[model samples]
Target: MPSTHNPGSSSPLTSFGRSIWSRREPFHSIEADHESSEQELELQSFQKLVVDLFHDLSAVSADELLSIAWIRKLLDVFVSCLDEFRVLLLKNKAQVSKPPLDHWADEYLDRSLKALDICNATRDGIEKIRTWHKHLEIVMCALESRKRAFSEGQFRRARKALMDLTLEMLDERDSGSVFSHRNWSFGRNNPRKDARRRQHSSGNSSGHSRSHSWSISNSWSAAKQLQSIANNLIAPRGNEIVATNGLAGSVYTMSSVLTFVLSALVAAIPCQDRALSTHFSIPQQYSWEEQKVEVEQELQELASICENFKNGLDPLERQIRQVFRRIMNCRTEGLEILSRANNLE
Candidate 1:
C-alpha cells in the first residue's frame, strides 16, 4: 500500500500524534529503539541514585531507622566480621568450633530481633522478612571473632541493636507507677543475668524442683502462644521470629524459675544447716569418701541429662537447629550474592 505525501500536504495522524502535536507527526518517522534505550538508562540511573541515597542515609539513619539501615550497612560490615571470624575459626577449628554457635545464637536470637524492626519497616510477608533474616544470620557467623568474646566494633554493633530495640519497645508502653513497677534494661549479651546466675553455687541448689511438670509446661505453653502470634508477622519461612521469641520466652521462663529457686533458698538458708545435720549427721555419720562418691554419681546423672537434651530433645532441638541453619545460610549466601551481583552491575 503506497501512499505518497507531498511537501505541503498533511495525512490524518494517530491518537499518539494528536496528543503530542495535535494530529501532526513531529517527524515523518521516529526511531523508537533509541528513545526506549535512553529511557531505560535514565530509569537505571534513578534506581542507582536511590540506592546511593540509602547508603548516605546509613550514617544518619542510626538515630532513626537503625535496624533497617544498619542491616543494609552490614553488607559491608559483616564482610569485615567474616574475615575476623574466619581467622579466629581457623585457630580454633579443630580446637573448638563453638564460635559458630555464638554467631548462630546472635541471628537465631539477636538477629531475629533485628528482623522484627525490618518487618515493621517493610510491612512485608513473613517469608520475605525471614529470607532476609536467615541470610544475615549466616553471614554474621562467618564474621564471628574469638577476640575477647567480640571486637569492640562488634560490641557496639550489638549494643546499637539492643538500644534501638529497647527504645522501640518501651516507647510504646508506660511502666505505670515508679514506686512499684518493672523497668526494662537491655545490655549487650545476657551479661548481668549470666553473672548473677553464676554467683549461685551448685552446692546451694535446692533439691526440690517444681513438684509438678504441668505447671512448668503451662508457662512455656502460654509463652509459645504469644510468641507464635508475634513470629507469624514475618513472611514465608519467617518462622525464625517465632523461634527467637520462643528462645527469649525460655530465657524469661528460666528467670522466673530462678526467682522461685532464689526465694526458696533464701527462705531455707536459716534452716539448711539444721536440716542437713538432722538427716546425715554430718562428719560423724558420713565419711568424706562416701560423700565424694555421692557427689560424683549426682554429677554423672546431671551430665547424662544434659547430653540427652543436646542429642535427643524429641523434636524441639531438630526444629530449632533447622531454622538456625537456614538463617545462617541465608545471611552468608545473600551477602556473597550481593557482592558478586553488585560487581556485575
Candidate 2:
C-alpha cells in the first residue's frame, strides 16, 4: 500500500470523495444558489450599462443630433425592450399557476410574479411617456399653425370686417325691411288714394284748399311731427363714426333710438286716441275704454319687439365673446410654444 500511494499525495479516490461530499447538499438549494448568483451578475451588468449610458449622454453636446428622429429611434428601442419584457412576464405568469404544496416554492413563485408585475408597470410607464411625447408634438404643430393664421393684423382685420357686416345688416333692417311691415302702418293713409285725389284737384282749387287748411292744420302738423320722429329714429347713425368705434357705438346708437321712440310713442298715444274719438261718434266713456285697450295692445306689441331685438343681440354678443376667447386662448398657447422653443434653443 505504501508503494502504491503516499499519504501526502492526492489521488483519483480523493476527487471522488470530494464529489460525493458535494452531493450531500440538497439539489434544490444548489440550484437556487446558482440562480441567485446569475441574477446578481445580470443586475450588476444592467446597472453598469445604465450608468455608462448616462455618463455618455451627459457628455454629448446638446446641439448634436438631438432631433425628433432621434427621440423616435430611442422610442423604437424602448418598444423592443418592452416587447421582450412582456414575453418574460408572460413566462413568469405561466409559471405562477397552482400554488405549490411547499411553502418555499409558493413564496418563490409569489416573488417571481411580483417582479413580473413591476416590469409590466415599467413598460406601461414607458408607453405613456411615448404617447405624451407624440401628443406634445401635435400640440406644438397646432400652435404654430394658429400663430400663423391669427396674427395681430389679421385679428384686427377680422374685427373690422365683423363690424362692417353688422352695420350693413342694421342698415337693411332700418331701411323698412324689418320694422316697416304693413301691420306697423295699420292706421296710416293709403298713398295711392291720396295721390289720386290730389291729381283730380285743379291748381286754383289746390291754392284755395291750402288757404282753408288752417282749420285742420293742427292735426296735419301733429301727424307730420310724428312721421318725422319715426323717420329720424329709424334712420342709420353716422356710418363713418360707427365704423371706427365698432359694436359699442352701434349698440349705443340703437339704445338711444329705442329711448327716443319710446318717448314719442308715449306722447302720441293720447293724441291718437283723441283723433279717433273725434272721427268716430261713440259714447265718451266707451271711447276712453277702447282707446285704453288699443294703447295697452300697442305697448305690449312694442315691448315684444324690444324683447326680440334684445334676444337676437344676446346671441350675437355671445358669439363675439366666444370668438374673442378663442383668440385669447390661441395667443396664450402661442406664447407658451415660444417659451418652450426658447428653452430648447
Candidate 3:
C-alpha cells in the first residue's frame, strides 16, 4: 500500500535517503558512518522544504486560495523551491552534467524560457487591470457625489465608464493579447543601458538577438505556451531513476511545480488565448500529488473570478487595488532574483 503520510512529512529518509544509503559502500569505519549520516541529513532537509511548501499552499481557505494574497504566497513558494533546487544542482554538478540529468536540466531551462514569456504577459495583465481600475474610479466618483442629489449627467458619465470597461474587457477576450503592442518589461528600465546590452548580446552565437528576443509577438499565445510546458512531463521510470542517482524525482518535482504555478497564473489573470483545460498526470507515488485536488479547486475558483471581474465595481475596485500592490511586490522580488543570478554568474 502507498504511504499514508505526506511524502516527506513522516520520515527524513525518503527516496533520496534510500538512494544515498544503497549507493554508499559498507561503512566499516566510524568516520564513514558519520559522513553517510550527514548525506542523509542534507537530503532530508531538501525533502522537508518541499513538503512544507505544499502543506502551506494546501492549508489556505477557499476564500483566500486564488486571491492576490494567495498568488503572492505562491510566487514566494516558487522562488524558495527554485533557490533550493539550484543549490542541489550545484552540489551535484557532476551528476547534473551527465547524460540523463543533463537532458533534464536542458528541458527545465527551456521551460524557464517559456515561463519568462508568461511573466511578461502577467505584467501586461497587471497593467490592464490598472486600466480597468481607472474606469472603476470614474464610476465611484460619478456616483458618490456630495451634492444635494444625483444628476442625470452624473448617471450618464457612470454609464459611459461602465460601458467602456465592459467593452474593453470583452475585446480583450477576442484579441488574445490586449497589451502586446506595449513595450513594457520588468528590467532594463534604462534605455541607454538596455540598448548597449542588446548590442553586446547581438553578436553571440545564440543566434537570437536580445532586443528581438524579449518582446512577445502579436501571435504569442499563453495557452499554447502552457501546453508546450506540459508536453512530456512524466515521472521517471525505475531505470531512469537509477541513472540519475535519484535526482530524477527532484527534477520532476520542480518541473511539475513550475507548470502548475504558471498554469494557475494564466487561469487567474487575463492572458492572450487564456485557457485552463490543460491536463497533468502527476505520479500517485509522490506525496505532493495529494495537494492536486486542492490546486484544481483553486484554479476553478480563479476561472470563475476572471469571468466575473466586471460584475461588481466596489468589490472589483478593492480587488484591483490589492492586485496592483501584489504585482508590484512580485516585481520587486523578480528583480531581486535577477540581481542574485547576476551576482552568482
User: Which model scores highest in lDDT?
Assistant: 3
Per residue, candidate 3 scores C-alpha lDDT tens digits across 211-323 of: 12256667778888899989998766666665766666667767777787777677666677772223333232323245545644654654454444444322332333333
Off by over 4 Å in 1: 1-64, 67-70, 97-345
Scored by Cα lDDT, where does model 3 land?
0.57
Error of 3 at 133 (Å): 0.7
Cα lDDT tens digits for candidate 1, 1-345: 011322121222122112222111111112233453442333233323333433343333223222222323322332332333333323322222132222332233333323222211121111122332333343344334444233445534534443443443343222211111211111112344335434432322221211111221212222232233234222212232133322222222212222222222222211111111112111223342445556446546545433433332223212222322333443454344334544654
Prediction 2 global C-alpha lDDT: 0.29
The residue-by-residue lDDT of candidate 2 on 169-268, one tens digit each, is 3443234222122221112333553364455332222211111111222123233433433342322234422222221122122223223322222222
Instruction: Report, for all candidates in order, the number of backbone clashes.
Output: 16, 0, 1
Candidate 2 Cα RMSD (Å)? 43.9
For residue 7, model 2's alpha carbon misses the true position, in angstroms, by 66
Model 3 segments beyond 4 Å from truth?
A: 1-40, 146-149, 179-215, 275-345
Sliding window of 10 residues with minimal summed lDDT for model 1: 269-278
Name the regions of candidate 2 deviating beyond 4 angstroms.
1-59, 64-67, 95-345
Q: Please identify which of the two predictions, 1 or 3, would achieve the higher TM-score against the true structure.
A: 3
Go through the candidates in order and give each one's C-alpha lDDT.
Answer: 0.28, 0.29, 0.57
